[model samples]
Target: MSSIASFVRGVETLNGWVGKTVAWLALGTVLVCFATVYLRYALNTNFTWLQEAYVWQHATAIVLGGAYTMMTGGFVRVDIFYGKMAPRNRALVDLFGTLLFLFPFMAVVGWAFWRHFWSAAVVGEGSPNPGGLPAWWLLKGTLVIFVALTTLQGLAMIGRSLLVFGGREEFAGTSSH
Candidate 1:
């Protein structure tokens, strides 16, 4: 149990780091957009990296930040069903949800997208609209980034479920939500 607790703590800490990293990345995206706008209008020159940067930078932050949403119980779901359940029952649902639905889906997306991204890299893929952006690396990176963060949060959720059913949760000062 203590080992699980330790693992939960470790996952939680990593999730926090991922969340912060993504937040900063999003902020940078915002700045980049502003720069692009300024460049386009004020300088009379279209920025080359803006389109690719827009897609991947925003996507990267979103991917990296998804785990924080899951771990914090911020994910959109059926509260009508969930809110009525007892703590133990809720834990059960969470455990099942993470294992059966969430993990598999994220895993599959990560797996498939990783390949797509990798292929893009291998082929030196890039936009070809005369002056687009080179961003196969950035786009592909999001596949792992999102999955890794989400997986970490999923592990923490699993740990929380274990705590709940084991009768050790009351002392843990943790809420599955």
Candidate 2:
């Protein structure tokens, strides 16, 4: 039980760190987007790389921050149904949802993204648009990162749920919002 608790805590801590780090990309995304728009309209010039830069930053932030969102209970759910349920019941739902939905979905997405990333990496793929960013494989790799982080968080949720089932509700961590 202590080992399970340690695992849960470790995963949550990792996701927290990742989430905090990835959050900086949001600011970068906003700044780059503003620059892109200002350059296009105010300066009467457009750079494809600048345009794609914000998009890439936004995607990276979103993909990398998924586990952090999960840890913080930020994902959408039917709160009307979930909110009314007891803690144990909620844990049951979480366990089933993680097992039945999250795992399988992430597996498929991870597999697909791995293939895409490998292909791009092998070729050193760059943006298709002229003057766009290079190393598109890095962007493609974010999908795999998303899957890994999301899956890790899902496992933590399962461990937390098991704690709840074992009458150790205090270790269950945050409730879904």
Candidate 3:
């Protein structure tokens, strides 16, 4: 139980740090997009690299920050059913969901990401568009990162659920969202 508690705390802290770090990419995405628009129209000039830059930033934020979103319970849910359940029942649902649905989904996606990233890295893939960004493999690698972080957060949720079911209220704290 202490080990579970420690795992939960560690995963939460990691996701929290990752969440905070990736959050800044949102601002970067907006700034770069605004600059691209401004430069294209006002300055009568266009740079493909700049155009791709904002797109890359947007993708980076979404891909890398998704685990943080999940950790924070920011994803939409069909709460009409879930919210009506008792706390223990809610924990059970989360536990089953994490095991049956979330873990399997993550595994499949993680496998696919590994294959895709490996292929891209072998070729040193870059943006297909002319004058676009290079080293697209780095962007590809974010898929694996997303899977890993999401898996860690899922494990934390599972630990929290177990704590709830075990009647460890002191450790369970609050239900995840």
Candidate 4:
């Protein structure tokens, strides 16, 4: 049990590190936006790539950081019924939801998305926008990446549910034993 707790702790720590990285990348997007405003309005010449760059970075950061958000309880949830449930009941609800819905969905969608990504990649696809952006497949790949991480997050959630049901503190809340 102690070893398992340590493993979870390591995952949580890795999650924090991943979150910080994405946050930094997102913050960098702010700087990129600033540069775009300068280039477009100030220099009187539009940089189309800048816009594409922002979308790519912004989306990547958010998707990659999703697990970290879940780790920190930063994602929105339908908590109307959740808040009313007792602890054990809540755990039960969470266990079933993760098992029956979340994990399987992530797996299936993640698998399906890779097919889309591969088709795009194999065809060397790009958007129809004239000088708009290059290689649409690159952006589409984020779907697979997001699903992979989000699936791991689902696994973490399941671990948390199990620990909670067994009456041991999980996530970042409990002291190391």
Q: What are the C-alpha RMSDs, in order, of all predicted structures? A: 2.6, 1.8, 1.8, 3.2
Consecutive 10-residue window with the lowest summed lDDT within model 2: 168-177
Spell out the clash pairs found in candidate 4. none
What ranking of all candidate models by lDDT puts the best one first?
2, 3, 1, 4
For residues 121-175, write the lDDT of model 4, one tens digit per residue: 9998886666667888988898887787666666666666667777874432221
Residues 41-90, model 3: lDDT tens digits: 99988999998888888888898888878877788989898888877887
| Per-model TM-score on C-alpha atoms | 0.86, 0.94, 0.93, 0.81
For candidate 4, the 10 contiguous residues with the lowest summed lDDT are 168-177
Candidate 1 per-residue lDDT, tens place, 1-177, comes to 889888887887778777776778878788888888888899988867685687667887787778877776667778997887777888888889889998999889988888887888888887776677775666777777778778877878888888878986562323343
Off by more than 4 A, model 1:
170-177
Q: Number of clashes in model 1?
A: 0
Q: Candidate 2 clashing pairs?
A: none
Candidate 3 overall Cα lDDT vs. reference? 0.85
Regions of candidate 3 where Cα sits further than 4 Å from its true position: 170-177
lDDT of 4 at 100: 93
Tens-place lDDT digits, model 2, residues 1-177: 899989988888888988999899999999999999999889999999999999999999999998899888888877998888888998999899999999999999999999999999999999999999999999999999999989999999999999999999786557332
Top candidate by TM-score: 2
The models' CA-based lDDT, in order, is: 0.77, 0.91, 0.85, 0.74
